[model samples]
Target: MNVDFWNEKFTQTPGLYGEEPNRFLKIQLQSLSPGYLLLPGEGEGRNALFAASKGWKVLALDQSPIAKKHTLEKARKNGLDIEYQVCDIEKFIHEGTKFDVIALIYFHLPSSIRAQIHARFEAMIKENGLLIIEGFGKNQLKFSSGGPKNTEMLYAIKEIKSDFPGITWEYEFEGNDILNEGIGHSGEADLVRLVGRKLSDYLIKISN
Candidate 1:
């Protein structure tokens, strides 16, 4: 909910993380058919535009209005359409709409609400839908690659898995990688990547 910070950040650069979609997201979608995809904390529309290009109905959200402006500008140039909104991600997570895919790429949240938000995102996905994520991992503080400097915001595989017990993890890895997305992401980084499927409607509801 740090709107002012991220809004100022978007102004400082035309492309903070570059216009390219996350490589992990690109790879994961290749094997699946395009469907309704929701991207939260979507910073400049890179992933949204990419998904829309491939014929997926994309809804992108971020707290910064500037981010939406930049994304829409790029989408226009590329002849892509993405529904973008400027609002708190937590608020949007509780909406009634269901999606066929949900992706979170470097979208770090405070520890206080991380589990609840993650669980809500899980609830929003359709049965048999996919959830893919790529983010800075627990060991990222040792690396120079870009991520929230706050340790609590960094993801841990065990914690993330615990957040979504209903998920059938198709792929999971915590490793080091060389990031080259843009000026914001460069050099070696510790990352956690996962691709999971919500295979059925009979999941045990998350606790309050």
Candidate 2:
């Protein structure tokens, strides 16, 4: 994670990702019951703030202090209280804590450690928990929109399925879409979206 890069990003702009929540996230959350929602790399707090407003206990983590500060400021103005931590995602650990939902919207990471971080996040989900993700597809290189320039940082559907095995995929697709999240993510983009539910521990045991 580049703290300086994100620090400057959030500080330089009022809302780099905009104040509105991701469209996919908003739709999914609307139908599901509100519970503990965990958002990693929650830059600028748009999604986290939306979850908080919807009566979900939101817990967000980011590497940039400026991002956290901006998030808190937004929460305060919205009259919402959200738990936020400024730290590396790898170093964040909540012992014996589990969440009902984990959102990974646009949380692109270096390929070297993305798998490890994902596995750790998977372990934090309670039985039947939902994992929602939306990120730039491997084909995103063709577009001049937001996302990392490194192909390794982008996502592929096959890799997502392999990364979170033993879960039932409720929805999964990879295609192009017009994204207008903010000044950062605007225009047409190759996107990958997924929603998976963790199999119950008992079910896994019995199947094994």
Candidate 3:
């Protein structure tokens, strides 16, 4: 979707997506230590603000300027300061940066862009860093809660495994159910969730 599309969506309903972290994200990140957390496609700042409340330094990025404004306002209202940027993910550079934890929650782009983004993500993580992703599955087309209509935009376990070959898969699963992430992500939805870690030197050396 383009900036105008999202701007119109946010304008139609000031908080169309609501102000709360994704359920899956909250659950998976709770046990991890606080550190630099990156939230790509972080619409409306719910997840970023939530992480901020937990003392995590967050960098939220999105393409919509309107989204950037609203997210900042939301963070301010919660007495939190979250670093937000308005940039197209395709053009954003991820060089000389490493994150302890990176999150890709409900960010769907075309396969071509997705492949490139995944590669950058792999390079951006420090050894043993975590990657948490939750998105619509290929089967989501059959369900109607929310997500890209294109099957190619959705994710699968095998696809993720192939994309991040050096990462040790910690968790992977799919299910259909109501997602109570405020309001937007609700009702019966087909989703895929994964938590993985970059392989450490010990494991890499062993493999060799």
Candidate 4:
């Protein structure tokens, strides 16, 4: 990913993306107790800052320095303290730390990289932890909303289930509608929404 491309994008006024938590994220986390939250591809920190406002200890990671700077500035403006890191998703290492909630919102990566990242995400979640994810589904290209033109970058239910079998589905579905994420994401879109909880020691074996 080109850091400059995103930097220049966020160089404009208020932010490239406005300061608001994702609607789906807010709803999913509403009933849960506050705890550590991981936000990958957390550009400009709008989501992270909002989560911090809700008492979540948020760790926002992005690849752009300008993104990090804007995130900190926005957090300070909101009187919130958020840990911001300038790091690419492919290079991130979680060590022994695990999160109660891991949110993946509109962060698209190549299929290979996504596979690796999904594995890491599974390892970084505490038992019974919730994983909330929203992304453009395969049908997104038919809509005018912002997203990659390539279908490979989009998500499918089967792909997610196969990749992270440890997560028991609480809710999973696809739909077409409006998405408000500022410049990069807006307008009529097709998306996949998932809210899942990590399974305990139980494991199911599938034969191909």
**If both were scored by TM-score, which would come out higher, candidate 1 or candidate 4?**
1
Report how far residue 52 has shifted in candidate 4, in Å: 0.1
Ranking by lDDT: 2, 1, 4, 3
Clashing pairs in 2: none
> TM-score of model 4 relative to the true fold?
0.92
Q: Which digits, one per residue and each the tens of the lDDT, describe model 4 over residues 1-208?
A: 4788788777764465567778899888788999999999888887898889999999988988888888898788879989888987788898856899999988888887788889789878888999999889999889877777889989987897677878888999798878777766778899998999887534433321
lDDT of 1 by residue, 75-109 (tens): 99989989998888667744666899999999999
Candidate 2 ranges beyond 4 A from true positions: 205-208
Error of 1 at 171 (Å): 0.3
Q: Is candidate 2 or candidate 3 better by lDDT?
A: 2
TM-score of 1: 0.95
lDDT per residue (tens digit) for residues 1-208 in model 3: 7899988887777776667778889987799889989999998888998899999989899998888899898778879989898998878776655889989999888987777788777777889899998998888888767788788888786886687766888898887777766556667888888899988756756875
lDDT of 4: 0.83
lDDT of 2: 0.89
TM-score of each: 0.95, 0.96, 0.92, 0.92
lDDT of each: 0.89, 0.89, 0.83, 0.83
Q: In model 3, what are the clashing residue pairs, if there are any?
A: none
lDDT of 2 by residue, 38-77 (tens): 9998988999999999999999999998988888998999
Candidate scoring better on TM-score of 1 and 2: 2
TM-score of decoy 3: 0.92
Scanning candidate 2 in windows of ten residues, the lowest lDDT window is: 199-208
Clashing pairs in 1: none
